[model samples]
Target: MPELLTTSGNIALTPATFQHRLLEWYDRHGRKTLPWQQDKAPYRVWVSEIMLQQTQVATVIDYYRRFMARFPDVHALAAASQDEVLHLWTGLGYYARGRNLHKAAQILVERYGGEFPVHSLEAMTALPGIGRSTAGAIIAISTGQRGVILDGNVKRVLARLHAVAGWPGKPAVERELWRLAERYTPDERLDDYSQAIMDLGATLCKRGTPSCLFCPFEDVCLAHAQGEERRFPESKPRKVLPERQTIMLLLRNEEGRLLLEQRPGAGIWGGLWCFPQFDDREALSRWIDAKAPGAILEPAWNSFAHTFSHFRLHIVPQPARCKRTGHVSEVDTLWYDSARPANIGLAAPVKQLLNASRPFAAQPSF
Candidate 1:
């Protein structure tokens, strides 16, 4: 590891020195009032960690509060149905995280008596969604144990501090950062130290326009020294996201209830409720004709796009007022009432479409 000099250019900033300075800053500015921080229970910390993965703290607060209100502990979460758990998770983009979290809770309740295996990193990582860094955070934050985390925020902070080269997604680069994370993690005050590093990165060493002057490592940060604070922790190689188009069927019943289908358990928007989709207008028309012979198909609503990490989905919401012939299966299909929405998961785009359909809800009587 390269040595970093202090502001006077006279002394080296060792690991101990680094921890001390970070903790000092944390004592003043670190986020101590986050919903999860108030109660450092392993379950709470674990949920917060999962929610915060690839999600901003500001966006997670309300979701976390609602989730905790429903499922107060691992036992409660485990006992709840997947639909109920996922219902609370709607609007939180990553559905897989929500699924794995519920599964892990079940595993913990069944195998570990609903208690976290705080002493065992292996046990913690063995859980469905708990990776190494997340496990480290849970143990350290909940128990104040010696645990090191290399979350995105920490990765950015450390990458610039030593000016680490290469995209952090690379195995080599990630391994090096993990080593640095451990080297600097203090023995005492593990909870504060963990939060401090993450806070420093989020607040000061931001992805764009970092506040270099206010940073604790302002003078010692190698990237700052080179006037290339954003250069380190190289970005992943870019790729053109493929665009896929689909027609979303917004079939409404006489009672003004919208029809929704539970998506297959493993795909885009898995395990969530979504409007029936068709490849094109012809296919949509065919399904409508076969299912509801006298259903009135309205003009297609304005097209919109919902971009995912891998692809862009162009959605054309095809609204329809239909008379049902027989009872619809309740297993995978549902009649959703907007006023009394069931606790079921809906993707962001589906929710948007539902909201958009509100103004046009009073269809002409047949």
Candidate 2:
């Protein structure tokens, strides 16, 4: 009988003690009616799990609804084009999730006859982006199978509950956390227990300022008892994000068509349409002068900054008018009506800029 031990003291976690305490709180206060919880179908659980990665539930609600309405099932999703799938997942950061979902759907249809495999962690992990945690979640939640899950929310919860110190990113810390998770997971009610733990972490044991007053485990929580609830999961040293500067060319042709190019299918904002960009203003000016000589250059429209987890991008938008009669296929360039940008795959930031300028572009003022 494995027991729950904390840095402060060792506490026996019998079935009755754990269930009576946690389940009582869950029954009264846990989140119950989330859209994904409505169906325990493997597909539904898989989609929601993937969408919930590094994204908030509030942000994923509309996207999830729209995505389900569009794809509806594994077959539908597998049959859809990558471009369409990526377009649907446009605003969702971490584009890799969308791409992986598409790939996984295809794998399910072709390899497993459009049904998720049962208790096949290896098969699930073989898919593009279905990691160990995600595969475990699908198996545990949908099939009621016992498996280890180590998502960020779960990590935070377990780290604090056990007072596991050191950066959770390190291999040693992660192994200890996994051991604790494996030990505490109940045999029966596996799915419900998984959801309960995740809910506890998401709702009560949040990263910053946890709601200790309402937490069921507050009585036994070592961190809470020690009056250092926030200090359980020791913080890691931070590194400064590097800054990058770039110039974006907002070029238009004679017939109100914008010139854009599709980015390569790797790196930042891959496979999305954007204005021709250069790392430096001098390089941009040289390219424009050489390619489209005597083109009229207007004042800069907007200067904005977009930050990623690791880097910050400072972008300057320079509007220009050019007339050229050479082949554009060599440069991956295309001209499209700015009003209908969805026809082409424009990145979210580019789409925002285009939509903001639509009203002005519509009105004819000399």
Candidate 3:
């Protein structure tokens, strides 16, 4: 088929020509310097895809480097404990990704002998935290399979390119997008094409203030033509996020270790270390009396709000200087010496709170 082009030299994206144009543009101007791009191993692709979910590339870059440095491969990740895994993933929010990555690594080690099951997309998706799009990305980027992906960036890129209507989360709209993705994915240069579309989405077709003039598909993008790029990828239905309150303690011993407890592996901040939390001051005092017999309580700090995806947490931090050395040691609780830093994984808010409270230390303020 003859290629269609605009006077500005950009090609009109059709199923046959979209890959060529995108890849041509990607060759000249795509972000190939990403840490994961240097090595197209399935493990690296899978890890990068998971970290990129709901997170910007710039933010994930440092986290990805640190995580890869710690857990170099599946064998290294599988042999490590969950605490160790979560610790490396501390500041990276959506912690379930960390847990699920650990869980999936164990499964891979046990079932596939410490390697990603790159032979099939279905096998990859069968593991924890590996969705269809992620699985496709892992396979397509690593093995040059004609696998299709529809992550947030690709979703926006495709939605605008095709002018897809309705929310991408909707069943019907998603099915259509999936069909389009499958149709457009090229048989040749599959890896470059996959990365090209993703790079295009992340760079040009952004959520706010898209650089339409620079996009390769500028002449062909339906949404761009209609001046409704944002409208194509419809927003999710909005609902009110709930708010809750709690008292978070930052107890310190004479040795200058902060009291940190491992959270249960199910709810918010699951399997992560945080200070003891209470619904009210009364409950907090009762626990303190029972746990630290001669601990002296410092003046409480004002309640501050931390927003989660579903709720807002109003945290009242109550720091204490404990003189007692006879406190019972709980299995999952510890006096964490922040000086060591790498022994445990802390929740983001806890880390922030502790960092902000350094001046007080274990000594009480008047």
Candidate 4:
């Protein structure tokens, strides 16, 4: 394991000096042209903060612009339908953020007359998807209130600056980092300071090959001084991703409508439309034989492999043409107009498969 720098052999940081040095560095080189920095309105800040969670700033840039164009304000978000919100948030992996944003907007409209409650931390956290760090950031940036932010970028910056040991996810390390964050946050110019610190961490104090030469705190950064900046906040143990095999049945009617089912709202790819999936080939064959006895099973067109954070999905696509127009009792399915897949929430990979199969679906034979 790598070592962290110690202050007076104490191994902890001197918060006052650290804050002064970091703030000075921020004034000189921190990011200043981000979209969120242009405006400090509660809605703008809140939207950007939510979108930035577990997502890169570069990736969030265009998404933020389009999202703002659609919603414009909290009231607009609250009024939009769930489908509409999800549609705008497609390609953004975390669907829960969109749902929570919509929920919080509704709450804001109902409870606070469409205005964000900026006075208290408790009031802010009471809104959906706004945890401690998010609530703190909103209040700090929008209202100039002093608070701590502990996102991944800030965590990496602090861990390297102080050479804090142990995983940041652990409670003890998190508590120490929180204390450091609170200590460094200036009482005045709180919003600019907050954004500055985040920008510093993101731009110069990055995860890989950090540009320490341009960093404001390079002079005093313990990890940099110790020649082990990349080793701070020791990496966690890795786990093997389990693999799961499944079959996706593409059942189509004579009129070229493909069957898709809406997934239940609480699991992998929740609330998205996907083809009827089965765990085993035996079960799938039995389902097809019993449900559509006279249907013609076409050769498999393609296979899709998608990896989630926790597991890997092997989707085997089997196309079949059904003779009957009526619904099958066993399968929870519906035949959708193949051209208008946007009517439902289809996962990205499934959408790709549909698009790939468009030419085949348009032809007379499967």
The candidate that achieves the highest lDDT relative to the unseen native structure: 1
Tell me the alpha-carbon RMSD of every candidate: 3.3, 3.5, 3.6, 4.0
Over 192-220, each residue of candidate 3 has an lDDT whose tens digit, in order, gives 98999998888878888899988878778
Q: Please tell me which model should have the higher TM-score, number 1 or number 2.
A: 1
lDDT of 2: 0.79
Between candidates 1 and 3, name the one with more favorable lDDT: 1
Query: Candidate 1's residue-wise lDDT over 1-366, tens digit each?
Result: 244343333247689989989999999988899999998999999999999999999999999999999999999999999999999999998899999999999999999999999999999999999999999999899999998899999999999888889999999999999999998998999999999999998988899989998888887888887788879889999999999999999989888888899999888899999999999888987887776677889988878898999999988888989887344446799888888889889999898878777755653321
The alpha-carbon deviation from the true structure for residue 107 of candidate 3, after best TM-score superposition, in angstroms, is: 1.5
Error of model 4, residue 345, in angstroms: 2.9
Model 2 lDDT per residue over 8-59, tens place: 4536545456656776777788887888889889999999999999999899
lDDT, candidates in the order shown: 0.89, 0.79, 0.85, 0.80
lDDT of 4 by residue, 251-338 (tens): 8887887778777766776666788889987888887787777777788865668888888888788888998867463454677775
Q: Which ten residues in a row have the lowest lDDT in candidate 4?
A: 1-10
The pairs that clash in candidate 3 are none
Q: Tell me each candidate's TM-score.
A: 0.94, 0.91, 0.92, 0.88
Candidate 2 versus the native: TM-score?
Answer: 0.91
How many steric overlaps are in each model, in order?
Answer: 0, 0, 0, 0
> Candidates ranked by lDDT, best first?
1, 3, 4, 2
